[model samples]
Structures are given as C-alpha cells and as structure tokens.
Target chain A: MSPTGNRADWADDEDFDDPSVLPPQEVITNKDGTKTVISYRYNDDNKKVKVTRRIKTTVVREHVNPQVAERRKWEKFGLEKGHAAGPSFDTTSVGENIIFRPSVNWKANAKEAEKEGGEKGSMKDQLKDKKVKCRICSGEHFTARCPFKDTMAPVEEGTAAAPGVEAEEDAGGLGAGKSSYVPPHMRKGGAGGGEKMGGRFEKDDLATLRVTNVSELAEENELRDLFERFGRVTRVFLARDRETQRAKGFAFISYADRGDAALACEKVDGFGYRHLILRVEFAKRTT
Target chain B: MRPILLSGHERSLTQIKFNSDGDLLFSVSKDKIVCAWWSANGERLGTYNGHQGAVWTVDVSPNTILLATGSADNTVRLWNVKTGECVKVWEFSTAVKRVSFSPDGNRLLAVTEKRMGFNGTIAVLDISYGENLSAQAAEPTLTIVCEESKATVAGWSFLSKYIIAGHEDGSVSQYDPKSGDQLENVQIHEFDSQITDIQFAPDRLSFITASKDKSAKLLSSRNLAILKTYISDTPLNTASVTPKKEFVILGGGQAAMDVTTTSARQGKFEARFYHKVFEDECGRVRGHFGPLNTIDVHPAGTAYASGGEDGYVRVHHFDKSYFDFMYEVEREQARK
Candidate 1:
C-alpha cells in the first residue's frame, strides 16, 4: 500500500511498487515569496523516502571601489588555473566563532572568567582550615590507608552508642570532640536503606555465577559457548588487566533464570578448559 | 566573529599585505610561492611562482597594478597583478629580507641581509607604470650602507620625504631619500634586541615598531622620537595601526622553536588590540597554534588578517561592538 498522504494522481500509486524509480521533484512558490521543494530518494534501508523543504533567500548589497570591482573579474592563474569559482574545501574553511568585545578593564574581566573556569582553586580555598583526621586513630591521613584500619573499629564507637549523653559532652567541649562522622546506613533515624556503589546490579546477583580459575587465554566468546549448554546466558563479564589486556582468572556469567544459574554452576565447577579447571559458584552480594 | 581560514601556504608565513583598496591580500611564505586571496571571501585569486628560495616579504602597489616580493634567492621580483606573470627580477649579493612600495607607488625599496662579507644595504628602484612593465631600470637609483647595524625593515615617510629604516640593534634611523645620508638615528627599543617589523600609519607621519624586547612603540617619522609604548608579555613579531579607529593590533607569541614545548594557552599566540591614545589593551583574539609571523589591517579599517607560523591566514571582519566601544572621556568628547 502507498503510505504517502494526499496523492493527487493515480499514477503516484504505481510508483510505490517499483522501488528503483523515483518521481520528478516539484517546486512551488508560495504567496510570501518562499519556495517549497519536494523530492524523492532511497534511504539506507532501500526504502523510498520523500523530502520537503522550505527556503527563503535574501540578497545583500555592498558598494566597493571601482578598482576592486575590476580586479574581481581577473582569472585564476598559476596553481589555481581554470579552477571552479568560489573557495575550494581543501584551501579555505570557516573556523569556530569567537566573541570579541572591547572593554576598558579587559584584563580584570579575563581573570574573572579564568577563576570561574578553574573551580578547583576556589574549592581548595574553601577547605583550607579543614583537617584530614583519620577515623581509626585520628591521624592526619585517609581512613582507608590508615595503619590501624584492619585492626581497630572507629575511635568514636562509644560516643555513637550513647547519643543523649554525648550531646551534652559535645556542647561543653566542641573542639575536643571531633566525632561528627556518621555511616550512611545509620543516618536519619536509620529508616532509609544504605545506597550501594553498584546498586543497579544487585537484583541480578541471584542468577549470576562467579567463575574463578579461568585461564588467561580464555576468551569471552569461548566461555559463553561452553556455558550455553545449561541455560540461556544474558551477560558475560571478564576481568582483564588494563595494560596487558590479559584475563585476570575471574569472570561473571548471568543467566535468565536462577534455576539455570544453579545448574550451570554445578556442571561447570569441575570442567576443564584451556589447561585449567573452572571453579563456579553462586555470586555473593557485595557489602 | 568567525574568521575565514586560508590554508594555501605549506610552510610558515613570512609576510602578508592588503592592497590599497583592501580587497586583495598577498601572502608570502617559506614555501617558495606567493598567494593572492580575495579578502572578502578567502578565495584564492592566483599564485605567483618562479622564486627559487623561500619568499620573505610581499607588497602591493598603490595602483594595484604591480606586486613585489623579496626572497632568500638573493633577488627581488615584481609580478603583474592581473596575470600573475613575473615582470622583472633584481639580483643582489645577499638575500632580501624586506620590501615596500612608496606612498605614490613610483618607487620600491628592498632591504638585503648582511652575510658572507656583504654589508647590509637598502636599495631604492624607480618604478614605472608605462605600457611595458618589464622595461625597468637594471640598477638601483640609490643605495644606503649600514656599517654599524644592519637594517631589518624600511619604508617611506609621508610625501616620500624621508626613508625610515629599523635596525637590527633596536634603533630607527631617518635618511634623505636623494642623498642616501643618515639624517637622524635614535635607539627606540632595548639595546641589543632586533626590530622585527616596522609599519607606517595611514598618513605616514608616524610608524609602529615591533621588537624582540616584548614591546611595540609608536614613533614620529620626522625626528624618530618615541611617542607611545605598548607592553606585551611575549616577543612581538608584527604591529599595525588601524585607519578609521584609534586601535593598534599587535601579533606575537613565544619563539617558534620553543612552541612545541608549551601548550597553546601558554604560548600566547593571539592578536592583541590596544587603544592607540590610551595605551590600554582592549581585548585579544586567539586562534593560531604557533607564533604569529605577520599582521595587516584592512585599509578601510573594517577587517584585519593575520598570518602565523602555523601556515594559516585568518581574516576577521569586525562587528558592531568593536566600533561602539569608547572610554568615558571619549564618549563625553563625542557628545560635545
């Protein structure tokens, strides 16, 4: 069936069946002196497409010197002999627009613009007096790199246990008590749940199988084909070193159903591939 | 405003000049070719060929009938503007560094380099616009030898009364056009710094000099007295005075050899605009990737073009804001 709207002639219906042929373009002048052009072409999918465009033209007139006007008619010579009129793409191009406004205090305005662009400088100034006291031992370092991170809990655990008594103590010696840190899971009466870093993948954990002992030479496509015997695989993620681009002996394979995931884990745990035995199990949830 | 980029040269540009009518732009470069472009649309009109070495400078006659170029081939060649044909060639003992046409287009001056036991000299040739362009004088009418410091750039003063030349030792000297005798000499810039460019005002009463000392100075042509100074952060290669407005354009950056060691922002490759009377920088337009080698404003003062070491010529036409900017005192004077 012809999909174009308002076919004025019966001959237009016959052209739709023949994909190789296109109708001639039509141009119409409107009342406001605008032009409307309709043309037909074949798109990438080999389907016939019709394009309609409206264009307005304006003429700009400029007065130049008589000598300049005479020189404009000179012929191109040397390397550009007998070339087409107008600028060629290889020799001339329009650059990105630049906004230039003359001002009395241009240097001051430029400095302000630079300050706005480099936001890190202002942020450093705002954090000048702030200290980097660690949570483990109150050292001047990050909590993750602290020497006592693995051995001790946070230093203010007792104060967090008794908030009512600690409030009174905090009011008396505010500077001494640097125990204002709170975990995300314990904030706002502990009603809202904690937000995980990669929370979007939490729901897929049940149907995902963690595959370890993967050979460095094992490709993702080979692993997918090997695991496809048990179930329909939705995704396969292989961990690789950034520099060497070699597999890191670990991968994750997700299935459409939890039953298929369990079946694949049991069958693939003792399977041998690429001179290595694969060890597969259900993926554990990240804290 | 959007600039029109002309990429006709394959090597670093040495000089660029706009004709008196401000419709044609002539550019010479190290690529041994001279390209003439339409200033309005960036369309290349033609290329003048036949130079054996890198072209150093280019200038168009006031009548727009002849074009002259100096080159490292130790020769100066003139071309017919309409046909791009070499009309004549004048040979010298050393490479020609600069060339300029007189205000009335009746005389041409060429500055030759000092090399291989040859002292630097400024030679003036009489030009004729008769029916036969090639039947020109084979010898220079007069020659001025510089014993102390070589002349880098030279031009004629108003009414062709005095020939002003900028020296390699950062000094400017005025000489009698007929006698070839130095009338006055003054040190205008830092003592050992070389002057890179010298361009005259529309009336030729004064001129601006760009130097390696990171400053551009406007001086009176009659007595070589420094009138105004504009300080920049980078060594300037070229400076030009606008005709209809009270602004001067300065172009420069870090030296070309050190360009690869720094980023584009740190290189400071921009065309700076300064108020001629107030000596305050109004704004800057940045586009080139390397140091700017030359800059020329349109004779009508509506547009300007700059050539850089990156081998690109950018032509910019001013908008409303450029003409509307005025200081408080200037506005009050206009109101009166």
Candidate 2:
C-alpha cells in the first residue's frame, strides 16, 4: 500500500515499473526458528514456507533351495544312475552334439522309422543302417582288439600303455577325431581268419583231469577192495622203484577194456584217494 | 557173505570196521560210544567210552591189540580191542581226523587237521615201541598245508610213506612222508565245490575223491593228473578205491545205490581210464537221506558202511549176489 496518498497518485514510478519484481526468490528458516529472507523480495511475499523432500531406508530377505555341489555332479540316466553324484539339476542344458543336416532333414509330416515298418528298439531295426561299431577308439577294430584301446577296457589288446585321447591333447599331437568303431567279425582274428574253441587243451587229446590223491602201495586186499567196483580190473600195479622195491608213489590199474577204462576214467579220474587225487588213464594195451 | 544189520549206535555212527576174523564189528560214533558187536548175530559185545566229541576215524592194527580212534576233540585214544577200554589218550592242537598203522606195524600214522579254519595238516608220530607204548604220538614229523580253510588230513596211504590232504576247495594234495615235498595238487574235476571224502588207491599212484559237488574226480598222484570223473544226481559224499585194485565205490546223497567202477588203465596219451562197473537205481549203499558224511569199504573188502548227517549208519555187502541182496532189500521193504 506504500504510502499511497489519500488519492492514489497515478504517477510514472520507475521502480514500480521494474520487471525484476516478479523474479523468483528463496526463503530459509534460521537456527533461531525465525524466518529469514534469502532473496531480494523474500520478506515481501505473502507465504514464506518452503517445500522439502524426505529420504527413507528399507531392508528385505530371500531364501534359496538346497542344491547338490556342482563339482561332484554327473548326468546319468541308467547304468551310471546310482553312481557318484545326485540326479541332474542343472541351470544349463547339456545336449548331444546333434546337428540339423541334410540327412536328418525329412519330408513334412513324414515318419522315417514308420515308413520302414520297423520298431525303434528292434534288433533288426537297430542293425538296419548301423553296423557293428565299437564303442572305443572309433576304428575298424573291435573294442577287444582296438589298436588305440590300451588300458581299462576289459578286452584291451595291447598291454603297452597307449596315450589316452586327453593325454594326446596335452602332448600337442595331431589327434584324430573319434567317431565310431568296428566289431570282431569285421576285423580279422588271425592273419586272415578267426578263432574257435580251445585254450591249452587244443594241443593234446588228453582231457583236463582230476588226480585227487596218491597213497602207498599197501596190500593187495586193501587195493582190491577199493577199486573193484567200477569195472573188472585186469591189473593193478603199485608203481615201485626197481632198485629199492619201495613205493614209487603211484599205482596203475588196467580195466578190462577200453570202454570199461573210459567209464572208470570218468568216474575216478578226479576221485580222491585218501585225500589224494587218483590219476585215471587208459593203460597201454599189451594184448 | 551176507551182511545183516550187525548193530546201530544211538548217536551218529561215524566210523565202522571189522576185526580180522570178521566176527566182530567195531563202531565209534558222535555219541562218544564205541560199541563192539558180534558180526554174526548183531550182538553188542561191548561198549567203550571216553571220547568227548564225534569220533572221526578208527583203525585196527594187524597185531589186533590196538583199536585207535581219532576224534573231533583232537585226541587219539588207544583202546584194547578185546576189552573195549580206553588204554591211552594223545592230545593234539586240533581234530585228529585219521589214524593208520604202518605196514611194519611199528609206526603209527595219526593225521590231524590243524588250524581248523584253514588247511589240512598231517602229523606222523614215531612210536619206537611196537604195541607197548600207546600210539607214541610223537611231535609231528612233517607238516603239510592244503591251503584251503577247511582242509584236513584224511589218511595216510601207500604204506604210510605219503599223507593225503583233503581240501574244502574240492582239491586234494599229497606229501611225501620222508621229504615233506608237495607232490601233487589234484584238481578233482574242478568240482566247483567241497570234497566230501578222499581215499588213496592202494598202489599209491592214484586216488578217489567223492565230492559234495555231486561229482567224483579220480586224480593220479604221480602228476596230479585227472584220471576219471563221475557225475551223480546228488552230491557224492564218500568213496572207496577198491582193495582189489579193481574198482572205486562212491556213496553219496540219494544218487546211486552207490557207483562202482572197474579198474582204471594207463592209456597211451591220457593218464588212466576206468570202466563203469555197475550203477544202482537205489540210493548208494542203502543209507542216509541227508548228505553222506563218510564211506569206507572194509579194507578187507568184505563189507562197507556209511554215515550221514541224518545220524544213521548203513552197512552194505559187496559179495552178496544180486538176487540175494535183492531178497534182502525186499525183506527190508516188507518189514517197513
């Protein structure tokens, strides 16, 4: 109202005409709880209170489920299922190196196996396109005789320690990529053929026998009583040293004939004589 | 001769034998009762006592004064055959399984099973005294190991110069009496089981092994070579290589009346061959439904007896004609 005379003089006041009067200003409160003017027109405003923003602090908690240690984990579906680690619980999926290729591409709405009328797990179907491939060292050889199959596999052919595929990588060699292998029939057993029934017995006609025990050359009555049942015994000779007339630690019994001897051989070959094994054989025929 | 049921022991009869005259039969059993019976009339002549456990082996000396009995209790008790009294006792570490008299009748062969859990052992005692000192059961002259946990020295054969060892591994080993050298390890047919009984062929070159595997394997002592193999429907428990050197009789679980084979012969390439004498449809030796434990043809070849887990002693006659024996079997059936 500034001392406007009883009649407001409409004079051209230079200060009133200044545009700086509408300029913004700040109002701050003092420590004494008194309002203080921060700008040139602060004291002249109708309201002096200022607006301020407040800050707040908060906390939150979350729980995680128990997971097996990753280092000890192994992915096994069947044979190795009960093996070292727990079941597969993985964040990332591990898939076979399967690829989308020309051969894998099929006609739309087509079932290749169904087209052939073959079951999935059928032996014939399994053998349709797949040959007898070995599981190791993917070569034209059975796992048993694989040149690269050195140790650990049951039928390893070579005893000399061959470098493992992983070991070859460390050795920095031009390692061949492993694919699939061949089987025994595909590979030659010998120089050009295969093997058949026999181990050590292949050499001789004599069969593996059981000679249970050998006793002393005692009296004929005792000898006669024990052996007379199988067949008619032609001769019983207690093997003796020619010089000392002492028991040479054995005896020879001659059955009546070959059939009788064969039968006895079957019966007594491994029979125990006084905790010893009796060696039964066909005595060289004299007559 | 006809074999009548001479006598039966109340407890399981383990060993049976006849006196030289074949007049009296002596049987030692698990009941600790040693009974002497008159073979002619089934009369219990006398009873001897003192064995604490099952008597495993019994032998009669040629002189006839001594009746040596071996027991599972690990003691050899000498009894006067006539009096049926315990004359002497020889203590051992484990069960004394077999006892035999030397050909000379001067030394005693008492084969005992030591380390009861493992191997078969033999102890040969030198009793300088002929009939006076009780089986002079000396310190073991030789110790042989059969290696199997349940091995036992069953008997000494070949005139007491060699010891035969039976193994639970279905094998039999032999040792030279003088050298202690392991002469043989007979793989009785790879029986795949335990050997129930073994007997050395008298001539000492071969032996018979009856097994719990239902198969008997006769092995040659000379090379531990297998000479014969006998298959049966049930486990073969005991066998006797004939004193005639003619056959081997095997008795076992309800398989054969008992299977006997003819004498084995030496062949050109093979060790020896044996002939099948006869096979019986009935259970062997006419006894014991359970596992037959022991079978011995009287060293004299007159008759043999068998013992079994069923606790029965069964006696059989070899000389009985098939018809006469058949009549007897019929009579027994009629009685039943």
Candidate 3:
C-alpha cells in the first residue's frame, strides 16, 4: 500500500478477512427514487455503533514521517532543529528570565554559606563553604571589603584612609572593613564582582606599528612574517576594501614584547616592505 | 595552537572588543571596571573607572581616540582613551545595556531598559556636541521607544544611515537615524525568545543574531528574513562571524546553577565553529572553564577574543594549519 494514500489501498486488499469486523458503508439511490444499501452488521444498541478503521500490518510497519525523523537526526548532531513559540512550560515557570535563567545560580554557594554558618563568624568560617574567593583581589577578605577594591580611583579619600588604619589595628589584619566599602555601582544590586589579583602584562608591554602603501595582494601572513623576527606579532588588523575584501593601503601591527616593538618601530619605520614604506611607532597607550 | 589567556577581572566578563586599529583590547566585567590590553602582547593597560554599576557593553570610536561604555547605573559615559577620564556622562531614566559608535565616530547609540515598563528606548546622541549641558540640552538627537519589548542589543548599520535594535521578545526594530521614525519592527524568532547578540557581517548585507532558544541566525539586514540558522545543543549566549574564515563561533554553557551537578556539562562550555554555508560544525575550541559571555572576531579575521563567566579573556589566533584548512574550504566555496 502507498504510505500516503493508506485508506484506498487498504480497502482494495482482499487477503485474510475477519468476519467480526465491519466494512465501511456506502449508500446508493435507485431509479425508483428509493435509496438502498447492503449491510453485513446491524446496529442493535440504541446508540449508533461507531465504525473502526484499521491499517494493514505491512503499511503500519513501513511508514515514517520525514520531518520528525530529520529533527531527531539533527538533535543527535548537536543542533536544535526548530523554533519554539515561547519558552516551554518548564522554563517559564522555572527559568525566570533571560538574564537570569533557572539553569544558572551564581549565588548558590554564597546563599548556602549564609544559611548554614550564619553571619557572626571568622573570615574563614564565613567563607568556608563558599565557592568563590574575594572578588576584588581574590584574597581571603570579603568581596565588599577587599583591599584591592581601592585600585579603581578610590571613591572617597576618607575610605582609602580607613583601610590603612584598619590594616594597622588588626595586627594580623584580615581585610574586613573592605566589605563595608562596596563601590557605589556594585552596591546598587545588579550582578557584582569579587576582586581578582592583578593580571599579566603592564602598560609598557604594548606598542603599535602601521604599514603604509600595503599592496592589495598582501596577505596577513606576509605582514606577520615581516615583523615576526622583531618580536611576537600578536595581531595584524589589515584595513581592507569592503567590496573586494582586499588590503586598503595600510595595516596595524601589534607586538608582544615592548622592547622588540620599540626596536621594530625604530628600524622598520620608514623601511621598505614589498616596496612599501612602514610607519612604526609606540601606539599611544590609552590612559 | 593554545589560546593566550588574560586573567585579572574578579567577576564575570561581560564584553570584549578590539578597537578600530586592533592594537588595543578592552574588556569589561561585572567587576565594574573596564581593563584595556595591548592586543599583541597580552599586556594590561590602565582600567577605565567611574561606573557605579556593572558595565553591560562597550565600544570604541572609529578614530580610536574615545571609548563609550553602557552600564546598569542608567548612564552612558564617554572616555578619552588617552586621559582615562570620563569626558562626559549621559544619564537616563533606565539602565543602558548596549552602546555603539557610528562609522564616522560622530554619533553614539545606546539601548536603555526602562525602570518599570516593557518598552526599551534607543537614544542616538551627537557625541561631537560639546560637553556639560543642562538636562534638556543633553537630549538625544533621536529616540525610538520599543513597545512591549526591552532591547538587549543595538547598533548602527554600515554607512550609519539606520539604527537597529534587538529586543527581549525576539523583535528587531529599525529606525531612520535622520528622522527617528520607526521603519520596521518584526519578530525574528519565536515569542518570548531573548536576543543575546547581533553582529553585522563585514559586508553589511547581512547580520547574525544569537538567541537563547539554542539558535543563531543569519538574516538579511534589509528585510530581516532568516537566511540560515546555526543551531546548537546548549542555549547560545554569544556569537561572532570571521570575515576570512567564513566560520561562526558560538558560545554558551549550562546555567550557573546547574553546573555543579550536571553530568553533561562539557558541551555547555565549548565554543563550536560552524561552516557558514553548510551549517556543519568545522571544529570545537575548549578552554573556558565557565559559560562564555561574549566572543569577538578581529577585523583582520586572523584572530578572535572571548570573555567568560570565569573572569578571564582568551585571545585565540589561527595557526598555519588552521589557515590552510580555511583556504581549502574557501576554494571549495568558490568552485561551488
């Protein structure tokens, strides 16, 4: 039987019939103007008996919905296949909102610590169960009172003075008063951060060089090769034509080592690369 | 090749951007500080301070002289990169979530969420105007208030003629910068879907959007018709398109709350690269320990940077072998 047109093909099949099952009915009108029909079964119940439709065993075994099957295949490939009208019932009732989904809980550990340990405890006991360290310096102190919190232009001169005095009073000072000085922005109650230790690379490690009269045929690799010997070329952002996606006469080159960058600036500056002069300089550091 | 990781932020990294020159890398975190880095050497420059709240987004002017930041403090601040001082602050009645600079660097676009209503507002300010003015004098040049939806992302189309904003309800609204007239407001995804990011392709004919519904789509910049979809196993938080490689990088992870106990957590933290034409994943990059919040491809297309909930920014460059593979793929597309 054709999978899509199952009813007609199933009706035509004559193999293995069951006597108890009733066939679908058809009505006809005679020339005498009376309607006539033949029936193998009678509706004895006061309520009209309903007819049942059955598919052939072979047809039922072979048919498949391509769309649904294709969706399943994509799911295995790690891609969601279709769009949802809105969030599923589970998400709306549980996930909350986009910024804060039910799946994320950044405050989970902090909440657990507060619930079990209570507020009056030593710094160790207070953060004993917490997953993250102080957000300011990633130090042992509370995020609000982290000593490194003052790194960003101390909000109030008085607060910066307070930390120094507190440091002396607590001989083995733990950074406690730090929490009370939460920055104005952080204290306003959106997503706040804890302090992290200073990161690698200082202000002096950066230098920017420019390539002038770059050939349209020049590729990123060629520019990188020209400066790679001077130092590690971190990035080469080639200005290109929007339409053809070709070099647009100039490119900026950045280096990983300050000394190497400076040397490249002095030596390569005004030098020729593929017959084009290079403009090299310490790109002004954004204060 | 291994990715160069920059560590410093004490909290979740919210956004990262390469300046117009690609010499500087700026990253903002929930920590309330925006740190600048030498993109080439992974050197940390000075941090831009003054926001009293978590900064949501940041952008640099095309001239590379000024930086604009949006924050939950309900203000948009412009800073002189050389001075590290906030040159001007524009206050609003709502939190500013996204900011963008026009190609010409003369205007700044900000998307702000109202304090109480569903409507998000887009304000286009003439940054070239002199600083320090009365509240009335500082009014935006154009304002497009979204109805029944709050914007999550906003930007100026290439050429700076149009302003487009994406909303929490999967609706994208466009406005004529000249008159502030609403031109098109269409639902680009299923209802109740949130737009995570909207980045225009280098060519500007199309833009890509990442949605919380586990799909990233490439749509016509003009009509907003979805041209292609890049679906993923986890809800995508951000996405970026590489101009040269023709690959889309998608990032996300299990919700922070579920990470500790979930058995299938690995898939959530990996950034998958998908072929733009085939929609098939080319490869996966695994490095981030937590959910990735943002990803940005350098204009040169040789490298990309990502920030994550782990409070670290990672910069990945294409190695020789990777470039070879890209060239092979490019040839295949050209032949087709």
Candidate 4:
C-alpha cells in the first residue's frame, strides 16, 4: 500500500520529489492463477529500474508416515538452534541437474559422449588428414625440407615467381582466414565457388557407399576387406547393436576415390555374402 | 535429477546415514559436528555439537529415535535424534572408526581403531529405549578384539545373528553376536588393502565391502561367500546396495592428497552404478569435486545420498529412467 493516500497534506508530496524515492510495489492477481508483481529499484548506475515478475504457485501434497510428519516439525537444535524454517543459505543449496540414465553399454556411451565434448579428440580428428605442404615449392613436404628452400621465399612472401601460389597462400592466410567472418562468395578466389562446409570430409562423403542387407554377423574388418579390393578403403562403419554388439545388417564404406566407390557399388550390389544378398548404393548426403 | 547439496561440514565428510523412515538423513564429518537434515529438501533439522574431535562415523537406530556417532575423540556418543542432545558417551582407549545399529535397534556396535597400545576391537552395547534417553548401558555387552589385524568397519548381520567385521588386511570375519567369538574369517579383498566401508543389503543376508584395492564385493554375510564383484579404476571408499532397484552405488576417486595432481575427470569423482546381479556398470552420476567418502541409499530405494571429501553431502532422488533401464533379457522376461 502506498502512503500517498494516507498523507495529511499536499506538502507531503515532497517525499516523492526526491529522485531516490521509489514508488510502492504493485501486485495483481491474474485470472489464470498467476500473480504479476511490479517493483521499482535503483540499479548500480543509480538509474531507476522497474522489475516485473510473474509468480505461479503449485501445491504438491505427499503422503508420508505420521511419525515422519511429526519429525518434520522438530525444532532446530545445537548449532542450528533458533534458525528459521526452510534450508539455510550457508548449509544447503541445489546443485546442477545431472542426467543419470542407466544403460548396459554405459562405458561405450560415455566414451562417445566424451569424444563429442572433448576438444583434444575432435581437434585430432579434424587434423587427421591435414598435410604439410611446402610453402616455397608447393610440394608434399615441409617448407624447410623443400628443394627450393635456399633460393625461394615462402609463396606468401615471394614477389613474382608463383602467382597462383601467392593467390592460394593469400586466400589461406591473410584473406579472411581468421579474426573475421567473410561470406563464401566474397572471399578471395570466390569466383570458382569457395570451399564448402565440412572441409575435407565433404570429399570423403562423395567416395562413401552405403551397403545394406548385410548379414548380422558382418564385422567392420570383413567389410573393409570386401571393399578394399576396389580401392583403399578409408573407413568402414558397421552399425551394431549396443547390447549384443552384433552388426545391425548395414554398413558404410568410404574409399579414397569416388571412382572406386562407384566400381564397388556396381560390383557389390546383389552379391551374396553369408547367405544374404548385399545391396550397395552411394551414401546419400546427410542434411 | 537435481541433487540437493548440504554444506554444513567445514572439513571433509566421513559418513552419512538415512533413517529407517527415509525422511531424515544424518551426516557426520571430520569437522567434529553432526548434522541432521530432512532428506527431501536437504533442510538442516539441527546439529549435534558435542563431539570434541572429528566424527568418523554415524548411524541412526532402526526406530530413528537415537543417533550414534564414533569420533576421533576416542569415544562413541549416542544422541537423541530429535533433540540433537548427546545422550551418552562411552570412552575408549583409541579413536572409534565406525558405529552401527543392529537390525532390531537393541544393540549398537563400535569399531575402535588400533592405535597406541590398544588393539582394534568391535564392542557391542545394549541399547535401551527407556523413559530417559540418557539411560543407556555404560559397558559393552561383549567385545571382539582382533589380535592379528585391525578391523576397519563392521556391521550386524541379518536378525543380528552375527557380526561381520572387515579388517585392515582386507579379510572379513563373522563373529557370534552373543559370545563375541570369531565364527569364520575369510579374505574377501586383496591382502593388505584395507576395507574402507561395509554396508548391508536391505535383507541383511548379504553385504557389500569397499576396499582400497579398487574393488567392491558383495558377500554373503552368513558365510562370507563372494557373490559378485564390481571393479573400478580408482580405489573405492564406500558402497551401498539399493533396496527396490537391483543396483549398487559405488563412490570413490583418487585419494584426497593426490587430488591436486589430477583433473576432476581423471580423479574419477563420480558415483558409479552397478547392476547388483549382473555386476555390470550401468551408469555414473558425476558431481563431487573431491573423493566420495560415503554413500547411503534411501530405505525405499527412491533416493540416495553421498558425502564427499569436498565437505558437501549430495542427495539425489532417482529419476524414472533409473527404474526403466532394463537389459534385453530382462525386458523379454517382463514381456512373458
């Protein structure tokens, strides 16, 4: 209740003239069983701020033994003597919520979850296929090991010998590489359609084939062996049951080249293995 | 599930126990004070402030009328659970490491540490629910002294038929409760790896022993037969068998001294859940910053509380998923 109505004279309005004086809080009950509270307070900057909060109260009734109900009324004693009701701030607090789901393959699940959140593991995986390119001669070797290291500077620092290398180095190094975001179409060398998302993995996906109708006893190494005849298989992932650890009758095989993947798909389709005919097709792009 | 944290202890927590009703939780710590809290909300009901030294262990009577605590003060003190007043104190030659109430609440046992010139002993005192709560027996009814190896933790078996004691040498012994004579002794864990904690199953027919050898074993209390073993990477500090759910919660981590040398993930300060029958690790709930020193399951198995070396007691109520988890065979059996 505000004191404005209780004031005896208009001169009492002097209290409101002060900038520090805050208006009385107002609370209104809504029809939907919620209460709206509006209050005024001075913030850290000495500016008047209005706060609004909606409060909803729900009653949860629990049945318990009468003895427990009686014990709940016991008085605080010893060190906590004379304390008020509810948990004290110093002695009790609610901690972060923990998702505790029990599963048979908890170890494997935990490792996978950790790998997703772990920076070191993901960073290693990201740089798994990254190569060391010589800055001077564009060879598959370190710049210090390049044959032209003694005579030539790094392509980025060189003057006129390698224009293509300079442009490539500029696009990779100084041209919107870090510190700022540049749209794909606006980046250097953007005329030929800039690099796509997923980086090197996009090329690997093009060389991946989805093999279905595989026998449940199929193993990753077995699939790798079957697919490696066409070309060097980069990865073979066989879906398996988490509990039984048995293959789920499908697998994905990625080759080093899309041509090898196409050849494998054409030859492996409808091929019999373990009394089941396998159906092979190019793995569809996922999202 | 959101865990409620109780921060009444300033130093590391030693033990925590839930009353038979599962409504009240009692926790003792190395800070010399015992705290009683409502298990549902983690509201501190009161504090037992008479212990002069760090309290090593605590147990509430089956009726929840008396709370007994063993402390480094070399005494076992019984307190009126509701009033938080010390009812009786029994002095011993060495520090008391563990205290437990019998199944019927008529007898109390205290495990005294082997220190100075005294050998470790498990003494049973006759508890009375007389008109005056302070009117407890002054002397123990029987004392079982361990001459070869010191007993670290002990508890009463089913129907109080036997007293099971876990020793410093990782051996478990069953003794006749009436005569205090050793009935049988068996090495349940690795030799010389001390047994840190022993908690009885809901039926008391079996018990779980946590040892410094990084393993917890469920042994039949009658014959000390190892029924199942749950192994972990870090040494275990405490283990408890949940009642309704066929799960056992094991808590441990790197020793508190070595905690500074390892990160929290490496420290393994999470509560691991193992299938009681299958002995497979089902899940883990991580929260504590330090080693978990003690764990107690709710009598009804709806919730569990853990005390950590970080000086906080966390009470977690089980979620629906905890109960819904079932192996394929179990699901198949349920379908039948």
Best by DockQ: 4
lDDT tens digits, residue span B81-130, model 2: 65565767878878877776665565566666746464455656554445
Alpha-carbon local distance difference test for all models: 0.88, 0.53, 0.69, 0.88
- CA deviation > 4 Å runs, candidate 4: A1-58, A112-126, A131-287, B258-264
In order, what DockQ does each candidate have? 0.60, 0.00, 0.01, 0.62
Candidate 2, A77: how far from true, in Å?
78
Off by over 4 Å in 2: A1-287, B1-3, B19-24, B114-120, B128-131, B135-138, B145-150, B202-205, B243-247, B254-290, B318-336
C-alpha RMSD for every candidate:
18.1, 43.5, 40.2, 15.2
- Per-residue lDDT of A20-114 in model 3, one digit per residue for the tens? 55555645566765555544455776444554333222335644345323322221100111423322222112211111111113135435665
Query: What would the per-residue lDDT of candidate 2 be over residues A1-287, giving only the tens digit for each residue?
Result: 33433535666455477865543444556565555544433344655444432323345763322221221122322122233332122211122221211111223212454445544457875767765544442344575764433422222211112223323333332223243443334433321222221221121112211122356545444555566676676555554444666554445554545465567677777777665677766433111
**Residue-level lDDT tens digits of model 4 in A216-251:** 998888888898999999777776655788876777
Candidate 3 fraction of reference contacts recovered: 0.00
- Model 1 residue runs over 4 Å out of place are A1-25, A40-42, A45-48, A112-126, A129-287, B258-264
Cα distance off (Å), candidate 1, residue B101: 0.4
Please tell me which model should have the higher lDDT, number 1 or number 3: 1
Which CAPRI tier for candidate 4? medium
Model 3 lDDT, full chain set: 0.69
What is candidate 4's local distance difference test score?
0.88
For candidate 2, the per-residue lDDT at B290 reads 51
lDDT over C-alpha atoms for residue A123 of model 3: 86
Ranking by DockQ: 4, 1, 3, 2
